[model samples]
Target: MDLDEAFELVGEFGPRQKRLTAFLVLLQVFVAFQSMLIVLVGAVPEYHLDLEEIPASREVLAKHVRFASNFTSIATEWYLIKHDAYKVSLAASLYFAGLLIGNIMFGPLSDKLGRKPVYLTGIFFDVIFGYVSAFAPNYEIFAISRFFVGITNGGMSLVSFVLTQEYVGKSFWALTGSLTNLTFAVGIAIYALLGYYIREWRFLAFISNSPGLFFFLLSFMLPESPRWLYSQGRTAEAENVLQYIALGNGKERLSVKLKQCIGAVKKDDSESGVLSLVKHPVLRWRTVILMYIWSGRRKSTTAFLIFAGIACIFTMCLPENRGGFFFSPSILALCGKLTVSAAFNIIYIYTSELYPTVVRNAGLGVCSMTCRFGGILAPFVPSLKTLGPSVPFVVFGISGLSAGFLTLLLPETLNKPIAETIEDLQTSTYQMLKNKKVNQLEENS
Candidate 1:
């Protein structure tokens, strides 16, 4: 069949295929929650030991903070480690750095290798490191373990975004994308519940990640992306995977319609290197703009949120202020963090759908990395507690508003067909901008 005829025929099957794809891709939400619980566990603790409780020595307080900074120190029941606040602060930064490195690696890796391997690898990495974290002998080991956890967590992060765009029909992509964040919010809620009961940080770490092992084992049954397979010229393999999806979703045995549907996609023989991302003007813009939005959002949001939480801790601790139980302030700070988490998800889901598939993974990676970079400076926020928590909030609020504006810069994909190739994106985005200009001119006239 001719290209026009092929597109017409494929349109009918695309929606149904997208349904199956949504179920498969949404599994990443579970993975994301499991990966993030450790961060929450590490970060959201009640600062209980009073200065009076420790010997009247600055060195002792510093030692305590350092001990707590170590993952194993967090697990220690006997020693009230005080001085290592800086270490804990640094570990938190490392956790985010680990997440940054993982996000950066997954994009190129997913582009080179197929999605399933990376997804499964992320799960396994989380599982192995998660268990190691539970039993880490010292703060140094625990700090290193958190970095590895970040790497695995990053892989888990991208697969869902990629899968949703690939499998779901264009119409459902935006809302489907948002659902991952909503589910992540639910995970945070679960972590909160777990935190209440599993006060022992080591046990909390173990329980939080235990689900990842199960998910990794379950991933064996998950099918690889047929679109990815087809893109690489593995036609038969793509067809085989698509057929299984059709059958799994209870469609009648693979019809010739299904075969012809995916068979129609053109192969991408262009080099899949870093340069490929910059080779085209449109693709290059998508990568950079998305990266900027991501970076701005993460940096601003994370920095402010971290500072805010530290302020709340100080408020709860000071007798001159509304000094109350330690958990009271920590809980309030945790509640405030919910807002940050919600904003991050909303922006990410919207941004992921903004770019076409040609640059989707690259775009998402840049955004994710941007957020991680923002998180890198998050540790320093505590130093500014004297300026007030609202200061950080103002910064994050601006970043969020800026990112929201950037989202407006993106062409909406609703009702529009998903762009599966570089040519399609170039034409579509060009015409979109052109139409907007024409509308502006017509309005002025």
Candidate 2:
């Protein structure tokens, strides 16, 4: 019996699983907070430069005052006063760049070192850097600190999601994974509320960073993925974790059954890396498709939103600014957000199901890295405004639509057992193709 079979005997969504899943999902709140904090922290506030002190020609004074009034950004608190608003974009891009780097480094590290350690280390550093960002004396320092924060944020978010999925049975994969993202949405709302009340960015930063402390404390209670332990030939530890899980579900007697299953299960000690995704013929195509879909999803979502924002620019006559949330533009924007968010949730769950345990995190990391690349480039998409207002949207829309079409090529994993090894994946692919060929032959006959 495999780990998934054993999980069924114990209880898939038992009390223990719920507890662990909740704790891990809650960690996403801080990830959201740190990620979206830039929306407010990088905001360029409207301000005026005092022209009374400096003597200048009337025309020169007018020009200086006009430029000063337009020159605004949180980074301007330190420097870049003479620079264009791209400084803010650069700072934001650096944070996403850090996320890209973290995903590259920590995804495989979790597979090698274990999920618990990587997650704990990520949260610890996330907290440290969060505080550093709050107290940064200069814009350069703040940007650097935020970059580190992004690195930790990327690792923590990836590990936590993978860790959560690892604990549950395949039947609950979609439910649990999608539900986990809801916290991130809630965190965004909470940040908005905080922004409304707290005028100071530093104070808001401090409050946002405070949640990582709580998460770090709660993380101690999380156990290593039992499936991972079993894969590593650490049957004794795996048994202990399963026993704890069974006990939590009030099925302590199943411990013996779990032990028997664990004994029969073979361990996969093979090492895998990013390249492993493409090493096998079957997995290689799947990996490529997954990467493209990831990139397309991000590009589509970001570009569409930017397009919607441009639409809002022309429709400023709407009452949304007056107080109503049901304006046409607002509703359209919300719908787009909802659609993209649901797509994100589905893709995350889908990617988790597609990869084997040996390289699951790595696969996720690479896919997420591609998604981050989209994010890194998303900021620049708006610059296409120089071409035309609809031009960026057209580009994003085409990418998104193409991605949507290509998704039909992916094999359905609904109610399917998680693939535990590359051999399992290859065998399944072979059998599926053979069956398809047989069906076609029968039709021809």
Candidate 3:
């Protein structure tokens, strides 16, 4: 029997199964560390350096502190070095561009290579670039590092969704997917609480990066996805790996099923590539919509977030213009950051389950790209502060909500076997929608 047949024959087991399952959960820590590192890129150490001890007014102090928290800020400082607003906007734009380039490449890679290897490689790049960013002697190098970091780190983010979904039993897919992104929310919450105590920018950079070393070690302990191995026609190795997984999970060895699965494996499958994706109508449509959604979501979130942060900064920087009770702009920025972080995690779970496995990576990639692109547009909301804060929020909120509505177009894949190809996807959907009405009529008898 195949693995599916074997699952049916053996049926589900009990508490001992839970003990074995613990090992799977343990693997997520490495992915989670990567998530935490990517988010910390925004609020770096230089942000707090000069201002923390300044005796001058907020505006004067901000200038002393290098008030340029992003790449735009860096650029402005480089040229119009004294113009804080221009610099802030410029820095935000640069970060968005980084995400755009990174996201464009991350999907194809995960699709071509198995999720595990690509994920580890991405993390390695992130740690290396992140350290380089810390020592960047100038704004241009810093921007270059940030852009590369975004690309590498962007790939790292996708693996959590892919790996967790690939390895676990179908029943646990939603929960694992949700928690994988939820790591960001948790990271943001921790960052918020810690931000007050840790004001030095460089020290913060050091602390943020320290987790990556642990990931470098933890990657060794993670098993490559058996699903990927099987797909690649490495059945013997896949089976051995699966046996260990079963053993680790306290289940009986499934040798016969492994043999059956291996026998079923055939070569000459469709390779994942840009051309391959574009050639198929279903994948083509899925890719376009997903990319639109991904780009829109990223732009929307980033635009609103930077808008809010800049507004708060302006408030703190100007006394005559300062309105209301005073909380430092940094603290306010933390609030916005944490809010976006929570929203991102919640949205990803919903998006991840929205496609069949045949196109899961493709679909998720499109959606993720949408989110990142929305963030890219986020930094450019100049009129929002000049016009009103509510303006940007409303615009972004509407854009995100619109993406949520588009989500309804997708079917939920929870508890379903992962589809293997476009044909599998079509047949599965046909049965779900087509057979349902027929079954209902027959049931009336």
- What is the TM-score of each predicted model, taking all chains together? 0.70, 0.80, 0.67
lDDT of 2 by residue, 142-181 (tens): 8898899889899879988988888988788777787788
Q: Provide the overall lDDT of each model, using Cα atoms, as 2-decimal numbers.
A: 0.59, 0.74, 0.54
Index of the highest-TM-score prediction: 2
Error of 3 at 118 (Å): 1.2
TM-score of 2: 0.80
Best by lDDT: 2
Name model 2 segments beyond 4 Å from true. 51-73, 256-271, 297-337, 383-390, 429-445
Q: How high is the lDDT of residue 191 in model 3? A: 59
Model 2 scores worst on lDDT over the 10 consecutive residues at 256-265
Each prediction's number of clashing residue pairs: 17, 0, 30
Model 1 lDDT tens row, 182-249? 66666777777776666667787778778777667776876776656655556577656655555545
Summarize candidate 3's per-residue lDDT along 14-104 as a digit string, tens digits: 3323432343344344334334433433433234434345443544544555543443323323332333335434444555565556656
Question: Of models 1 and 3, which has the larger lDDT?
Answer: 1
| Candidate 2 clash pair list | none
Clashes of 1: 17
